[model samples]
Every structure is written in structure tokens, then in C-alpha cells.
Target chain A: MQSENLISPGFADPVFQSQAAFRALLTALSEPGLIQQVAPGFAAPEGLEPATAIALLTLADYETPIWLPAALRDGPAGAWLRFHCGAALVEEPAQASFAVIDGAAEAPLLADFNPGTDQFPDRSTTVLVQCAGLAGGDIVTLSGPGIAGSRDIAPIGLRPGFWAEFSANAELYPLGVDLILSQGEAVLGLPRSTQIVEVR
Target chain B: MTIHQSIPGEDTKPAYNYAYLDEQTKRMIRRALLKAVAVPGYQVPFGSREMPLARGWGTGGIQITAAIIGPDDKLKVIDQGADDTTNAVSIRRFFERTADATTTEMTEDATIIQTRHRIPEAPLTSGQIMVYQVPQPEPLRKLEPRELETRKMHAWAEYGLMQVKLYENIARFGEVTTTYDYPVSVNGRYVMAPSPIPKFDNPKMHMSPSLQLFGAGREKRIYAVPPHTSVRSLDFEDHPFRIQSWAEPCGLCGAKDSYLDEVVTDDQGGRMFVCSDSHYCETRREQGHRGTMLADASASGLVEAKS
Candidate 1:
């Protein structure tokens, strides 16, 4: 894992930068469909968005197992993650605490990852997907605990039938994966508790 | 580039990291917090760190505050609804020094509130985060002593034992005798312990605009109730859950709705009930809201002057 291939430093001021990023992530998750900007000043490798990289750097640790698709695994992304975050790379998607899905990669079935048990629903995976853009795509309205009434978001670059799969995943209630969709420097969250409806 | 260092006048070097806990620990706790919010009321296990404060004395809430607090936040700390108490003062000062954030006693001005044993009488608005200090995060701890058994029960949504316990209380006392630390079901799914707050404040947990987070350091657990979440106190149809009420208003602020603290005035069994929330009382008094005690004192003073 020590093989050097131009790995970037974690953060200029690790504490302040990570704290800011964490707060943004919290806001994004707390208010589902809310997009928050994350400018951590870390240079992300190719094929990985800066927001996704910032989220991983702020949330993942050695104890957290990260799953990367073949595209992300073969590139410099895996090494970069291992170098900076010290997160373990898991082979199986279901075993991962966090998983990264690139825009070009096929979206894995939500059931492939852990939805956690009834007792410990928080043990479910947090999926970070790289999107082409956060705005001007298929519009979906979200309503849930954090939302006041409803929030509309349209994330681009997702494969067809993503919402259908998400609808099924949301049915899990207390047991489902939480998603963070990143495009460039913006990230939007869609927690399991959120009720999503296509604006067709 | 050294960002933090001890000055010449300082006795001991300020060696502690910003907000006390290191960045790694904060990240770990932050991840747990996100999950806790995602699944409201579910207790998510985290690596709780040791703070300067003792275990039971709000170490859990301190850790959560430390993880989330930044330079921009306005913090408020309260113990039993009073901002001037020992625990509240110490916690407030701690954040002021470490996080360098502004501290306020007023509930309306605070962005983040860390409280033990009580919720503020004033309603919390949207965007504010309430952190509750919890000694015991498990709602079924008393009923089922075994941790493994209780975890299984929670997994299966087995709350029959809790219902039975409440039923027995009703059968014995003709009403539910339990008052503080009332158990509530979060989002109609996970039954949660809403800290040691009096039953009177339990209604504030339902559909509240502010996000509520609970931390139990000794138990190494963190849980949350997101904004607009449903929190229902456990009760039966025959005897619905009721809050504590008093015939007498606050002796200091003339507030009939706020929770009162019974103060012993003399050894001759004289007592006066005052508002537990000192800030609320002070604010009301400033607005010319006088209680019975104040009225009596002013009247006696006028009588002495005339004589």
C-alpha cells in the first residue's frame, strides 16, 4: 500500500477542513435532497468528483471498509483513498461500510449492499455516487422528517430505472442504504427515510 | 506552521487539540451521527472518547458538541433548565475556551444547545440542534438487565415487557407513577429514552423543528431525532400519557405554563414554586411580569414606608 503514485495530502488544516466538510455532510443528510457545497481544497484523482472525495476523507477511517467498482479500483483512486484515509478496501459490496459508484459504472442494485438489521439499522452502507450534474435532470420530489414539506432534486448521470430501484430501497424503512450524490463540488443526500416521487 | 501554541503568560501549554477531541475521533463520531439521524431513534454505536468531565456528568453530550461545534456556532448549555448551574456553567465555559464559540444563556439566540435533565420552556425553531446528555441511552435497560437480550428485543421490536411494566404501574398506583426520563417511540419505530427530562417536556419531542441528538458516553451510544419526526410517549388507550401540571404559577415570573422548581423558604414548611428556567424567569420579570412573591415583597415595602 506504500507504493507511491502521486498521492495527495489529506487536508491543509485537517481539523478545520474536515470539520467544515463533516458539517456540510450532516446538513445534506439531515435535510434530504438538499445540496451542500464541500470545498476541502484537496485534489481528487481522476474519475472521482471532489465532493465525493471530500465526503470520504471526512467520514471514512481505517475501521470503515470501502468498496470501489472496478473502474475506481484499477485507477489511482483506490491507492489515494488507502494512503490518505487509511480505509480498508473490501472486495464484496455488501461488506463495505461505504461504497463509491462512478458515473460511467453500472449502478449496483441497492439490495447488493447492506441495509442493516432491524436492531442496528445504522450499520447499513452509505453509498456515494458520482453524477454528471446535480441539476436539470429527472425531477424527483422528496418528503420526510427533515424536510419541511417537499424538496425537488434532479441528479444527472444516473442509469435508467434508478428511481424505481430507489423506491424499492426506500420501502425498507429503518433498513436501507443512505445515498450521497456528488457532481463536481456539490453533494446531495437521499436518506432511507425520504419518500421520493417522480415529477412526471 | 504552528497554529496553536502556549503563550508566555500561560501556566501550562495549551496542548489539547481544537475542541478537545482529535480530528480522527471527530470524523468517527460524525459518521455515527449521520447514521443516527438517518435512522431516527436507533442507537448507533460509536467509539466514545474520554473528556475532562466525568462519565455521568454529560460526557456524552460534550463529545457530541465537541464533534459538531465550530467557530461560527453560538452555544448554550443548561442543567435542569438553569443556565447558571454548575454543570451548565462549566460546559459553557469549556466550549468558550476550546471551540472559541459564542455562548449564550438565552434559548432564542443559541444555535446549538447542550442540556441535561430538561428542555427549554421556549420552543426551539428550525436550524437549531439540541444535544441531550444521556446517562442511559437504552430504554429497556431497567426492564431487561441483560444487554444481549435487550438488543435482541429491540431488533425484533419486542416492547411487550415495557408495556407490561407500564401496565403494572397503572394497576398499582392507578396512574403511571414515572415522571422524568419518560420513554418515547421515535418515528413510530424505535422506542427511545428522551434523557432525564421531566415528562412535562416530552411533548416538545414530537414534530419539533430542531434536530435532537442524544449521546450516552458511558454506554458508547449515539442516537438522534431529526426535525419534524414523530415522538410518542408510551401509554395505553384507557390512561393516556399526561404532563405534570401545577395550580400555582411561578413565584418569580408569574408563568403558569413553565415547569416550576419547589423552593423551601423556611423551616416552618413554607415553600414557593419558581420557574426552573432562570433565563425565562428573568426575561419575564424584565417585561414587568411579577409573581406573587415579588408582589408581596413590594407591598410590604410600601406599607413600611407609609408607616
Candidate 2:
């Protein structure tokens, strides 16, 4: 299907791909820190991964503004998203309702994104980051509400320098940004509520 | 005005993003959904915005659906499950036009089912998720209107008030007057409103394989029943949980094990019983449950003539 023409009339009727995306998101959100696959046959943005694009499509709306990393900010990818999804591009990360980082390596530390205010922790930003791998490796011990005691998740790629930043971010408690790390088709969640520690 | 004046093109610029929500709104909803799922029947308070649709008309279901829908998935929207009824048609048509996902009438075929007033009679599988449109999310809202008070009540595990209300209902009507949206406690912690589905559908919510999500747009809350979660209707042991019973079969499907919709057919109030789950009814009919009209027609060999 032609890229421009494909989305215009909306996905050919009856399957309801958007609704499926919505349900996947709820399941992902419900079981926080769990990996859920995005619907098949969805077109991923040039630099953005499928998981990131799926999250964007399901949650992004007219009222929210999106911030794209410098790499994909000015191109056909940007125009295509604007034309189809109607998300606005914001210069600052704090102003962005949703921020898409092509790769977590370049993604700003947890503190750079909005952690929200004392009264309303839910006002925080949700960062969708792209990763090279999603599973299988040294496990990070995570403890939180959804987790039984300490659940092991595949270690996420991050700069060693960012540890101090995240440690400080964790201190903020109720006010912090949530994250979704995507690798091609696979998507894993890391809501702010989760306490993460690297286990040797 | 010429056709060009009305049509929106690349030059005109379409309003709204790919999924109709901006990122910030998506994050807000995502956070609420997480809390809803985490608490497991606790009504999470959210700042619900007005959708393009009306307040009471499936906005809660629509918001929850919007928060969860991804780009590559199938969606089914049903109001009583006909898929052609005015509201169902409008909602299915809404997602079809905006989100551009595939829509279907079949329950087994859909991955996400956004429903109102009823749940499908067919048992849902683990693969499927049900989003219910809730007018109110709090089971205690009618009993107590204040949010601060309810939070305190939940914190203290205080449900005596809800039990007392049910007890009063027993005293007044000799049975619970609540025919639909009957309150139920989840995992001994939170009391939740099971959308507005009639009491017959309440049992279906208990320990079902499918995940159940409830959203109230006007009230701005979200809640859920995870796969195989214990959900109990608030009642005395002697009172017991009961499903609405009818002596007659569905007028259209001739099925007995489904929720029946009461219909008034005559000035004398003669009634016709029919399946409230329109899709289930249609499926049974397709499988050959011929009701009064079809049965009479078939018995006379009029089916061939009609065809």
C-alpha cells in the first residue's frame, strides 16, 4: 500500500488495528514492566522502532505535544507522523507530552524529562526509547507493586555516567517519568514506580 | 463553495495527532491505567478530558480504548453486540475513521471489545480484553459522594456501609433492587462498580480468563480485573449471588443460557424475551436455533418460498 494513501482512509475496515493497539497498551500498563508485542503489520517510522511507534499511535492525541530526538526531527518521517497522527513537535523535553528517543544511549537521563509536581505525580512525561536488544542477559533486580518480590528484567543499555542521575531521580519518589524501552518489534515497560538495581 | 473548500488536504493540515491524543495526554492516561491495573479494582482518579463524543455515551470505554490501542491491532466495538445498532455503528465507525484499525462484529475475532450495558454471552479467552463504558466507577459513590471520605474508607478497609446499604435493600424489596451495576468487592480490598452490565453478567466477570478494564470518562477513573482474579458480589451468605432468571427462551435465538432482555409487546404488557447479547444471539441463530418466527416459517416449508 502507498504510504500516503494507506493511512488516509484509515486501515481497511473490520480488523480495528488501532483498538488492538489500545488493548495492548492497557495490558502493558496493567502488567507494568512486562513486554508485550505491538500489533503485526504496523509501519514503523524511519528511525523509531515498532514499540515506540505503537505507543505513540495509541496514546498521542491532539492535546499532547511530542518531542522527537534530533535525528528524526526534520524529515519525511516527521511529516508523515504529523500528517497522519497530528502530534506537534516540541523543542524542549519538559514541554513534550511524549518524547521519542531513537536510541536510549542518546536518550536524556531520567532527570531531564518531567517528573511532575508534588501534588500530582501523574503529570510526568513518558519516554519511549529504542534499544538494540530487549531480552536475555544479566538480570536487574526490580521490586514494586506488580512484581512479586524481586523480578529480573534483561539489563537495559545505559551510560554508566547516568547511574548517579537515575539514583537522584529515584529519590524524587512520586514525581518521576515512566519509560518504555523498545527493540525493533519487542517492547518492555519500566514505570516510575519500579525500583531498579543492577544485580551481579 | 467548491468541493476543494470543504475537503482537507495536505495544504489544509489535519488537526490532532496520529492517534488523536498528544503525548502528554497519552502519558497521563498511561499512568492512570497502570495504577488501575496495579490496584486491581481500585477506581483510580484521573483528569478525564472530553472526547468528541458525549459524556455518558461510551466516553469511558472510548478513553480506556484510546489509552490502550496501538497501531497494529484489531478492535471490536459493540453496544449490546449488534454492531449495526445506532450507537455501536457510530463507535465502530469512529475508530474506523480515526484510529484506522480493523473492526468486526464477531466476538471470537476481536482482540479488544469496547462494550456498553452488556457483556457477550460467549466466554472470553486470555487473548481478548474487554473495556467497559462506566457512567460511574466507584461502587461507593452512591453510598458516599466525597472522594476524601472514600479513600479513607478504603484505607481502613471499611465496607460496613456498603453491606448496610445492601441489607437495607433486602429489608425494603425482599431482594436487592439493583438490577445492574451491582457493587462487588475485589480481593477483599476495593469495592468496584462492574460497569452497568445487568446482574446476570456479573458472574462472568469473576475469575474470567480475559482481562476486564472499566473506565469512566466523566468521572475520570480506570479499574480492572486481572486474569483469574477473585471478584465477589457484596451480599450476605444467606442472600447469595443470583443471576436474573427467565422462564422463556430468546424470541430471536431460542437460546436459554444468556442474559435476556425484557421487551413489552402488547398494550396488556405481554412480554417477549430475547438475548441482550445480540452477537451471541446471531451466532446461535446461525448455528440453527430457530425462534418463534423462523420455527413457524420452517415448519410450513415457507423457508424455501421466502428464499
- Which of the numbered candidates is closest to the native, going by highest lDDT? 1
Alpha-carbon RMSD to native, per candidate: 3.3, 8.2
Per-residue lDDT of A136-175 in model 1, one digit per residue for the tens?
Answer: 9878888887887788998888887778778888899889
Q: Note the clash tally of each candidate.
A: 0, 30
Runs in model 2 deviating more than 4 A are A1-25, A29-34, A37-200, B1-16, B293-307
Worst 10 residues of 2 chain A by lDDT: A6-15
Q: For residues B58-141, write the lDDT of model 1, one tens digit per residue.
A: 999999999998877899999999999999999998877677769998899998999998899899998899999999999999
DockQ of each: 0.63, 0.15
Q: Which ranges in model 1 have alpha carbons more than 4 Å from their true place?
A: A1-4, A40-42, A197-199, B1-8, B295-307
Candidate of highest TM-score? 1
Which window of 10 residues has the lowest lDDT sum in candidate 2 chain B?
A: B1-10
Stretch of 10 with least lDDT, candidate 1 chain A: A102-111
